[model samples]
Target: MSITRRGFLGASLAAAMDGWQPAAAAGARVTLDQLQPGVYVARAHNAEVARANAGEVVPTLVHVTGAGVLVVDPGPQAAWGGALLGAIRALTPQPVRWVVNTHAHPENVLANAALARLRPRPVFLASAATAALMRQRCADCLARLQAQLGRAAMRGTTIVLPEPALQAGGWLHTGATAWQVQVHDNAHSASDTVLYAPQLRLLCAGGLAYQERVPEMQEASLQGWRQALRQLAALPADTVVATAPGTPAQTLVPTLAYLDALASGIGAALAAGCDASHAIDAVAAAPFRRWRHFHARHPLNVQRAWRQLEDLWMQGEPLA
Candidate 1:
């Protein structure tokens, strides 16, 4: 009951890996780094800067349990999932007992089937809100992933849901460890979930946060997301692990800064009577020009934030 996570995950590595055929086409390998004593993050390069590296690793967060592991955001595609499993095996012999999808993205949760096939089977966890988004967007999600990961790589990929899904701020206990789960709607995607281990001071902040990349808005609540970050910043936890495997939590400050800037820019543009397209274009300007996918992502963020601002303005919400 007093096992340190490093002891659990870094145990028995001499014979850790299962026999796995690495993806020759994807030409990528999932490598594990012990960020903390028991916490391992599987990451390749900055997929934000290089999407070709996106297939390299879907970037997952692993929590070491006594005889098992808890994974956050198991990557995209069956092949990537297989690679992720092998990476974990290299760290410990503990079976993956639970997987939490931060949101309804294929890159995060499509590997559920592969993990579900373990001997005792793993419990899949997600918010009911995220599950509903999966149901509504599964087909479209598959289509987009297939186009990105290629049809062959995605073979056997399916939508897997958490049974008895949590609503918000639910408790998940694994052996001697427990995680407080929080779910969000209109923050990142239609929904997002973050898991916090208070004892360990670690937070697996699903899609709610990003690093070294521009955050996208797929039915996002721009202002709501800002509020969510404010809440996360208030947490006593010092270390936060988001979907991006190797990035530091301190970078979250700039990411939050970017979102706030987008919101303020949209509000100012609207107040100045700039049209939606013009506002989006105007916001596509400076400071964020250096971010990955700035041109591609800025317009969408502006468009979404613009609408939310319009409604708030109509409701007499004060603008700064």
Candidate 2:
């Protein structure tokens, strides 16, 4: 029998309340590489989410603090989150005190289910907009991930909404470490939260920066994203963590180039009287065709950019 979305979510929540366990049979493992003395990152495979990768296509950031550990973007599934928690325990005995979801993407936030099992549960945090988006979309996202990766891989996963929304320009303190939160709306997703650790000169840029990966633009605003990137580029960060792998300074380069090309190509297409249907072909893809997921995601990016630019044009607003 087909289960309704509400029914599926309700069942998942019931399972979670009954002390769900990670699906160890799925063979998910987490490995960490030190970015600094106390900063580390688990780099996800730079590819689309699949059963083979277990939907683990987004990087997870870990900050070891004197008080406890702070985890950013836990992961895509409960099993992966359990593995990540184990990896952290191996490195430090301090409990995870804070869990930060940089955005509302499934791959970035669903892991909170496993992490929620902590004895002294970590304070889950995200922007107000992100929390709202999660409330609206996470159930469907969870169901989709399960369908894509199989129930075994996503077993025990459930949606866990973040609490105490983080405000832009506010400071998040844990132990001696402080992260300046930067919030952007209508950019990467409906809301994007960036964290900068001044002491470590490290920046967790969420989906605002992609490393050699073609960004998904389904919920993006081309102009807003570019503006947010510009603001991020001005920060004094020595290391940047994002969705894919890249060096500090070069982390944002490919994303910027892709967005710039997308905007200009779409604008020109609009000026030439191309509608959404033809705009995809009109936008040049040669420069970014080699990027990961280019073929799968770039065409959609072109369509989204065309629509946004066309809307602006209709209102007599410059499509810059």
Mind giving the per-residue lDDT tens digits that candidate 1 earns over 4-77?
22112222332232332434455335667777877877764545423465454345888788868988888776
- Regions of candidate 1 where Cα sits further than 4 Å from its true position: 1-28, 48-51, 54-57, 245-249, 277-285
Q: Among these predicted structures, which one has the highest TM-score?
A: 2
Note the residue pairs that clash in candidate 2.
none
Worst 10 contiguous positions by lDDT, candidate 2? 1-10
For model 2 the TM-score comes to 0.90
Error of 1 at 270 (Å): 3.1
lDDT of 2 by residue, 1-320 (tens): 11111111123333433555567687777777788888888857877788788888887998889899999999999888877776676677787889999998899999999888876778999988889889999999999998999998888898899985799999999899989999999888889999988888888998888876798888899999988888888878888898864555577766877788887888887788777878777767787777888888887788778888888988988766
